[model samples]
Target: MEKEATRKKYNISVEATLEVIGGKWKCVILCHLTHGRKRTSDLKRLMPSITQKMLTQQLRELEEDGVVNRIVYNQVPPRVEYELSEYGLSLESILNALCNWGETHIIKKYGDKYAVLEDSILNQ
Candidate 1:
């Protein structure tokens, strides 16, 4: 398939991985989803820095890539929720490793004051 051929063109596994998750917000969104399913509003609240447009765009992309699931509820006011797909859940270890590396980098660059913040992010 064309998809298979495109994947083969990547020189390394990391390149392939990056293709799926490469963006300013994808990994951060994934990290938040790792906690549990979240409504659009909840995600926006959790990541106040992201604009609504960017969050919606990233979520749509993740859904298309089979890394996220979107659930809709019909009602007077529609409700939508997003969670990681099984394939997305498979990234848990990788996400944790990335988080750990970031924590280490922060500690190395700054100092211990930010270590507590890292712990909280890891716990979340």
Candidate 2:
């Protein structure tokens, strides 16, 4: 009955959480937004490696998941700002723990120049 045990009905809630924050870039996005609201261009500026299209797509997913709030202003030049929602703020502890753990020991021990670039690659 290993199959039966392992194949229990999938829970939508768990899947939903994963859907929101499961991807390689979602957490990274959350990390940056945690500080304060930021304009779309500001995000791109800070993380120049991420393409605009991908950022838009991921932000859409995050907005759908109720993890982020996108505020648009009707100015002469349209402005958009992104900030984390209450649900997204819940990840603060988990994210902080990760940061602390990494800074305290992991980075010190590993000390690889490519460590930053290799985070998602090695994890996957």
Q: Can you write out model 1's per-residue Cα lDDT over 39-116, one digit (the tens) per residue?
A: 999888777789999999999999999999999999869999999999999999999898889878878877763545
TM-score of 1: 0.85
Worst 10 residues of 1 by lDDT: 113-122
**Best prediction by TM-score:** 1
TM values, all candidates: 0.85, 0.73
The lDDT of model 1 is 0.87
The list of candidate 2 runs beyond 4 A from truth reads: 1-16, 104-106, 112-124
lDDT of 2 by residue, 1-124 (tens): 4576665455676775566688777887887787889899977776778999999999999998789999999997889999999988998887777656766675577776366544543332
| The 10-residue segment with the lowest total lDDT in model 2 | 115-124
